[model samples]
Target: MGLLTNLKDSVSRVTDRLFASEDPKRIGIYGPPNAGKTTLANRIARDWTGDAIGPESHVPHETRRARRKEGVDIERNGQSVTIDIVDTPGVATKVDYKEFLDHDIEKDDAIRRSREATEGVAEAMHWLREDVDGVIYVLDSTTDPFTQVNTMLIGIIESRDLPVLIFANKIDLDQADIDRVADAFPEHETVPLSALEGDNMDEVYDKIAEYFA
Candidate 1:
């Protein structure tokens, strides 16, 4: 009996390995500036892969390019899914150099940052159109969820029939309202969590395993 159990366990391990070796799904993290997309991406990457995707910043467009961390394995309830995380620039209809000026950035650098941010938005859209297998749409729970950018982006994702998981981030704040975010997109699942505080991450992981896998 011991020998048989060991053999079965070995086969199960091999099966898990084979499934893990399959092509990883590409999940793009999208949201407006200061919505904590990079924060969440860094959290996910660190939890599984012991790495950071990008730096967090109070300045808008801090992540002026799409940063990708490949092969992150998230496991929950004995289920697992491997994904390539693409941390993208915040999607905004307009990016002005003057906005960075509020952060005390130099004029020349702010202008360059604005240009790069615009380009980054374009790149993010291109990836959504051609590469992304799933989406994690982060939103600031304290803010209104019915912005034009959010509507347009969600519409685009819906049009493509890509799977999406909406994250109502920053629940640690007193003003955070997860229900408001959920009600904005009643058709999809909305998860409430504070990525910075690492609150309710278990649900996030379980949902990722369930939806993206």
Candidate 2:
């Protein structure tokens, strides 16, 4: 078989397997700045024996733009599954375009972008309210998560009634404290992880799978 033919066959097999699953779920991975959301997304996509979907990065906000990757025909316990994981920008209290202002954006341009930022916030609210099925709220384990941004995020999740799995990322950091963050978001399930090191990824896999189940 040619390369293209082989590729088509693989795609067909994955599709068939996923549709055959008992229940399939699409998950959105989101969180605040520097929360390792991208890292976690990539880890989950790759760590599974199935096809890993997206690229992984170590830099904060590396995934300012949203990208999707798919895990093909992931079968567990005699059931086939597909994980549609979306890697979105880390939620921010302010528009990131503001950075251009300090970097010398023209006054008129900056003003218009500020307006756009407002619209972006609205878009984010809509996504939180209507779009996503679940969220993996990635928190920096080294910092206190009870801040306004986190609290506001929590409120939004609660309002939408979306199931959230707290991903306490950067557990490898010297100052990491998963316990403290766990205390802050006591209602949700928490998983300590070092996305770079690929630590505790199985737990994340199980958590996400549970949500779908």
lDDT per model vs. reference: 0.92, 0.69
Clashes of each: 0, 0
Model 2 regions more than 4 Å off: 1-23, 49-60, 71-78, 96-123
Between which residue pairs do clashes occur in model 2? none
**For residue 202, what is the lDDT in candidate 1?**
94
Candidates in order, TM-scores: namely 0.90, 0.71
State the lDDT at 83 in candidate 2: 63
lDDT of 2 by residue, 57-133 (tens): 44334454556665534555666556667666767777655564664677787666555645544555566776666
Tens digits of lDDT, candidate 1, 60-126: 9999889999999998777777899999999999999999998989999999999999999999899
